[model samples]
Target: MPKWPDDDVILFDGVCIFCSRWVRFIAKRDTAKRFRFTPIQSDYGARLARTFGIDPNDPDTNAVVHRGEAFLQSDAALTVLSHLPGWSWTRALLAVPKPLRNAVYGLIARNRYRIFGKYDACFVPDADLRARVIE
Candidate 1:
């Protein structure tokens, strides 16, 4: 479990090639203004990840926090889908099989940097997106 989150929080790898793309993608779909993001390498992200038993130096994939619990990998993806307007219905359908969902997610996470490319340093939030970050 995690501390109660006042809003949706995404904990991700800032330097990962695939993670960066997802951050940008989610930012674009945040019309309802319900989510926030931070890189696991950042101080804020590190603190949060540790609270949930995640390694800051190296993380498997994205983590989503709501209430006081942290959801990882495919479950995190499903949570995000359920919250975002366009994908809510699909989120419901995807919830049927957790093990299978994570197996696929894990495969991608294991090969992410190689397939998706990586950044030398964690991403830095721009002025416009800074407000969407906590700490």
Candidate 2:
């Protein structure tokens, strides 16, 4: 696996439209380029998933690795948001309780395909952002 330059990495389901959109959203606001991205289907992503004890082939959750720790599902999203400018406020939702946040995250993850759709192929970052992706 390639060594990721950034300390923060986002592992997402590349084939899921919603997940891809979420990644794009973060990329746009990441002024400091603090995050690196990888698709769960990629070799590196698969390795990381297995290392993290998640199903590599049928990943139902996204992850954010920050400061050498991994955060999953709702926690992952909030963690990413917390590091972005002006978005740290979203992390306050953590006060709502983990179980509740995960329940909502699970609902969306389970129905993401039906609601947001899926791609036949994994996402490909554009030229300017290609280096930021590890697929």
Candidate 3:
């Protein structure tokens, strides 16, 4: 099996506009530099996705790999947010119930392309943000 990094890593859809934008948002707010990123299109990302049981070809949800465990759907989003400064409050959403949270996440994820659009090519981070990307 492929080895994962020691730090938290977010695996996202690089061609999805919404997913790309979310990555930038997290990169900006993560002042502590606690997170790294991987685009699902990359070899490493694909391996990680498969290990977590997420389809790399037609991903319906993003994922977060932290402390050797994978968090999918709403749990993944909240886990990322919880690590951002002042964003720990997002964990409260956990109290709303997982099925409900995942339902909402699934809605957005399934429609993400039609609703937010897609890129003909995978997104490439700007120079400043490139350092945190794990190809």
TM-score of each: 0.90, 0.93, 0.95
Report the lDDT tens digits of candidate 3 across residue range 1-135: 344555599999999999999999999999988889999999988988998888999999999988878889999999999989999899898899999999999999999999999999899899978999888
Worst 10 residues of 1 by lDDT: 1-10
Each prediction's whole-model lDDT (CA):
0.82, 0.87, 0.91
| Candidate 1 TM-score to native | 0.90
Clashes of 3: 0
lDDT tens string, model 1, 5-46? 544899888889888888878888878778898888878889
User: Regarding TM-score, does 1 or 3 come out ahead?
Assistant: 3
Q: What is the RMSD of candidate 2?
A: 2.9
Q: Candidates 1 and 3: which is better by lDDT?
A: 3
Q: Between prediction 1 and prediction 2, which has the larger lDDT?
A: 2
Clashes of 1: 1
